[model samples]
Each structure stands twice: as C-alpha cells, then as structure tokens.
Target: MTQPWKPDRGIRHAVIALGTCGVALVAAGAVLDSLWLLGLGTWCLIIAIGMELIYRP
Candidate 1:
C-alpha cells in the first residue's frame, strides 16, 4: 500500500512567496531588459510550480 502525501503549511507559503517573487522579477526584467533577471525569475517560477505539482494530493 502507498502512503498519502501531505504538504507542510510553511513550505506551501514559501513556495507561494517564491512564485510571487519570480513573477515580480520577470516583470522587472522585462522593464529593464535584463536577460539574467528574466532567466532567474523563470527558474524560480518553474521550481515553485514543479514542487506544488509534486506535492499535490
């Protein structure tokens, strides 16, 4: 039998915060035309979303 999955509240909050920051960074990068910031933001977004998907019940 397989065990059910559960996510911690703190981790979920952190993920949400990370995703928000990522979106902000993406916008800032677009405004400033910075490729580095854009790439970093995209990475953060991907990681956060991936984690959420993996932990989803």
Candidate 2:
C-alpha cells in the first residue's frame, strides 16, 4: 500500500510554532489586560487554521 501524503517538515513545524505563540499571546493578553494582544493572538490562530485548510486538502 502506498503511504499517505504528508505536509513538509517545515510546514508542520511552523504550524506548531504558530499555535504555541498564539496561545502564549492570549495568555499574556489576559494577564496584562491588553485587548490588542488578544486580538493579535486571535488573528494568529485564525491564520494557522487558514493555512491548514489551504495546504491539507
């Protein structure tokens, strides 16, 4: 049987890093009561999702 297709290693690593940073930003935003940080983090998470959709199908 053929192996299933997979994303490139760099893409996988970048996605993971983006997710980690997104969570960290959210946490920092809460701690500092900063709406700007919260919004930025939210956008980061959304971009990660978009990338997955574009690349995984």
Q: Which stretches of candidate 2 lie over 4 Å from their true place?
A: 1-7
- Provide the clashing-pair count of each candidate structure: 0, 0
Over the stretch 1-57, how does candidate 2's per-residue lDDT look in tens digits? 855765466677777888888999999999999999999888888877777777765
Q: Tens digits of per-residue lDDT for model 1 on 1-57? A: 854764477679978998999999999999999999999999999989987887654
Error of 2 at 4 (Å): 15
Q: Which has the greatest TM-score?
A: 1
Cα-based lDDT for every prediction? 0.88, 0.83
lDDT of 2 at 52: 73
Q: Which RMSD does model 2 reach against the true structure? A: 2.9
The clash number for model 2 is: 0
TM-score of 2: 0.79
